[model samples]
Target chain A: MSSTASSTSTQIQLASRPVGWPTPENFRTVTVELPDLAEGEVRVANEFISVDPYMRGRMNDVKSYIPPFALDETMTGGAVGRVIASRAEDLPVGTAVLHQLGWRDIAQAEASAFRQVTEIHGAPLSLHLGILGMTGLTAYVGLTRIAGLRSGETVFISGAAGAVGSAAGQIARLLGAERVIGSAGSAEKVELLTSKYGFDAALNYKDAPVREQLPELALDGVDVFFDNVGGDHLEAALDVMNTGGRLALCGAIASYNAEEPTPGPDNLSALITRSLRMEGFTLGGHFDLADEYAQRMTEWFAAGEIAYDETVVGGIDHAVDAFLGMMQGQNTGKMVVRTA
Target chain B: MSSTASSTSTQIQLASRPVGWPTPENFRTVTVELPDLAEGEVRVANEFISVDPYMRGRMNDVKSYIPPFALDETMTGGAVGRVIASRAEDLPVGTAVLHQLGWRDIAQAEASAFRQVTEIHGAPLSLHLGILGMTGLTAYVGLTRIAGLRSGETVFISGAAGAVGSAAGQIARLLGAERVIGSAGSAEKVELLTSKYGFDAALNYKDAPVREQLPELALDGVDVFFDNVGGDHLEAALDVMNTGGRLALCGAIASYNAEEPTPGPDNLSALITRSLRMEGFTLGGHFDLADEYAQRMTEWFAAGEIAYDETVVGGIDHAVDAFLGMMQGQNTGKMVVRTA
Candidate 1:
């Protein structure tokens, strides 16, 4: 139904694996000639591309739930766009889709690799990359399924102003948590946690040790700890967790780029003494809950019971920058590169 | 009900709280006058007394699941014996009973605190302290209910020569595990794991780092990790765990007496990438499964599908020595002091 005559594409490639923290030199931008579409292939001009903390772990040449980002190849992640060219009958031109062909403005892949998204009447298309996408689903699955969050329970979240953490704070409140406490890196983020994200109490970890501050913030003790930043935050949460508490470990952003093995929480023995349960999970294994999350998330958004933030960095040229910024805690919520 | 003419009883009392490792001087043995049985009380002459790892935690003056032992008070633990003098109508003088008033020759407690144990036609009374008791039930609950052990799954256990660990090796086999590997502190204990307990492979953790030995022992990677010794053994299990692996943390005897905080596993980040689960539980939280565990364990014993051992230290005077020795890994299966 629609077509665009584009013969060239610009993409970011992982030139070499970084030693510790990745630098701009570790990535390279390249221009490549586009080829004609084959049968069952669709060409998409991406509207929004996600840059998440998990990508930092994939930058290393180590095996994980998802494979490492190969050298000299365009990095892949969640992206949403309109199908500008289609050789398949089922996914015709002008179809809105979501696919894993990010780090570039234009993507040509088999139609089956992309899934068509039904537009939310008034929501932005980029919401699929943040609140209604992997980030929001990760926060939901970790709280309801992994931690089994109950009403009248206290919850503590690390990286509380970031994408998944921000959503986790709100979701825990809606799920009937009696008190929600959060930890962030700066005073501004701490204020936003209570004023914007509805956290009962928020602390700036950089101001003091989390172990000493957590007990004071969580007056009654935390029943669920949704961990995003691991190292010290995890250790602190373990110290103040209530008996039979649950920890939903979504990310260890604190140690993702460390050069050497980081020491784990010293208070892990608390798990035994308190009979706690700590479960680590990735979003891919829990796709079965996506529809349920979307339905509930959509309803909450409609009723103004949910809110999300995005730090949009303009252009595909800045995709690597956006990723690096997200890893460095430069974003308040989801960091997405607007490539169109 | 016949009553003994003896008016004196001897017992061990905690003299001073230990800082790092406990010593003989920390306990004292003294004689106390025995009082006549009250309306609802009974006098039990213990046949066997248990000295377990969990007792080390209770010795410290800190809050835990169980209250700490008070200064100058007699220590308490599991014991099996015959009721000597009973004033309660529910319990007869000659009834076999299991109670929590050990570390002494004679224990006088309310009849409700002691439960009657129907004598197994041919089993020794000591089996109530090892395989058919708390130790055996711990292994069953951790493997079956907590770890959710499945058939054809490789299982690894740390401190696999101790009471709970020894029973865990056999229980994993009976539960249809594909491979069962274990680690102990010495060669003799390691040998017992394979020869007597039917472990597929056993390692002496003292000879080499568990992290180096686990990969070779568990070539296919481990699905369930029954943690009895925490520190290094837990770290090693985290390294080679299969995706979606389950770790049932039963005890952390390795760091039970540490004066300073111990560093936990450095590779805990493996939890996130592998989508692993680590849950800590105590036997008290799982008493509901006692009957089920006893029935299955008894059946296994009858079929000759299970084997167990006990390191008995004779006489009540040696009760403190037995407990100290057990804490140092001196005993094999169950460490019991026979007072009769």
Candidate 2:
């Protein structure tokens, strides 16, 4: 085995399972010396480690679609990097790659562990972690497949300033939605939803009850609800949904940090009254549409029709802070750690 | 109009909209002199008036699939009767018929308003209000069309001793469900579900919390949940649902009489974790399958594969008591007012 004589990786590991909300004490920073590369191994320096809401679910020691993160181990998630050294035939030096080795500065693994990607018009490598990657795909699949959004229907997306929600709002408009409404936490994000993301109306959920505000904006009733915030947002969507409405349950950031289970929508009887359908899904199950989505997204990007934002924090040491900030609605778009 | 000079009709009228649970004061019994039948009118003496759970929804003045019953007007619903006098050709004096002019001893309406239904091998005329009528079709639609129950899947039903729930359990088995479980408010109803309705297991919801007990009974997880009582029952179902499970929301009797909206399941996050689908529907939208359901139900009844029970309250004066009793979970099966 050929060795990298002096390379070290800075990583964040789960120190303890969070109770209610996570804090700095729940994580531990570890520095590990890189080992010798095997015959087909590669050494990659991560550029940006993605922080997402779904990752919070994995930190808990519970059964879900994806297994829980092992305690006292490095966090594993989406990251974009450049393979600086390799023993593989296909992926040589300076190959930009994407891998599931997040919350770290250096990733050393088998060559097959990383997927090669190209820089788009000299854009930042972190673009692969947000709009052009899994985040965008999550939004696309939720609108087209999970919600079955049809042309000329109205769409309402919660957490509209966040990664998937921002992508979803724009995608809904492109899908021929007659009207698009969104809910976000801050006045700035609410302004951005209408000014930047093509949302017809936006609600600053922090200002007033979502249920009260949604009706004022969605006067005709919502035809589709792409839910990223569950709790009150879900109840609000139910309150103003048209008959035969569809709800795509993508995330529940509302109760993600709750010590006890949060009570769901009070008017679920609307499901029966309006003959509604509500489905929950994750991106892992709908990869069949990846190729098609990539093609459409690239076209949309080239035409200057798609817009995205990112909130990047510097240094690997700040990854925990970045995650906590994202969870607390501090991020306007995709939250990513510039590990490099 | 030629009058039936000596004949009279006793009718139950909605006195006012109910605030919470309805009491006898919410209804008023009135006797009216019968007017003579017009050229196309018929005077039918009702045999039985169906006092169903859905009727409670009509007592509230809210927008729904069906309009609320008008105050000071006779309540209208499913009723089976025989034509005592007819001014039309299709229906003779002895013809058994069905119509939507219930809560009355005599229904005198245009001939076109009543439907002719033949007695099935000496079965009581009231059977048309239950197994051979809308009640049975409700169960069939929830299982097949709404939940999409396939052969060899496990099914769970709430309010299993009630009309629709009882039929759903039997029909789920007939559709080749591997197992059928049910929950009822009393031990006797629970016993009847297993003994008479062919349920694989039955839960007396009064005995324990449904969420705690469901896990012990539904060890393998529930695939289809036919919900009639939708408060804790919905939460319990969410707790034990398998991946890709489906829920058919038929009724929410648990909160029907509540002055305020009921909080839904706290564990709705299970929808996303398990990638589950929940849908709500009423029989009105699925009436296209009514003929198919009726054919199958008659066959099941003939072959002794379908069992039914009715809590028949004698006399028109006690009709309010029957409805109140059914709402309080006093009935074992369909509750009816035997007017004849």
**Cα DockQ of the candidate 2 complex:** 0.87
Residue A33 in candidate 1 has what lDDT? 85
**Candidate 1 lDDT tens digits, A54-167:** 888888988899999999999888999988888999888888999988788888889999999878888878889888888999999999999999999999999999999999
Please compute DockQ, using alpha carbons, for every candidate against the native two-chain complex: 0.90, 0.87
Native contacts retained by candidate 2: 0.96
Model 1, residue pairs in steric clash = none
Q: In candidate 1 chain B, where is summed lDDT lowest over 10 consecutive residues?
A: B1-10
lDDT per residue for candidate 1 within B1-340, as digits (tens), equals: 4645345678899999998899989999988998877899888889999999999999999889999998899988999998888888888888899998878888887999899997877788988999999999999999999999999999999999999999999999999999999999999999889899999999999998999999998888999999998999999999999999999999999899898998988999998999999999999889999999989988888898888899999998998889889999999999999988
lDDT of each: 0.91, 0.92
TM-score winner: 1
- The C-alpha stretches of model 2 lying farther than 4 A from their native spots are A1-6, B1-6
* Per-residue accuracy of model 2 over A161-190 as CA lDDT, tens digit each: 999999999989988999999999989999
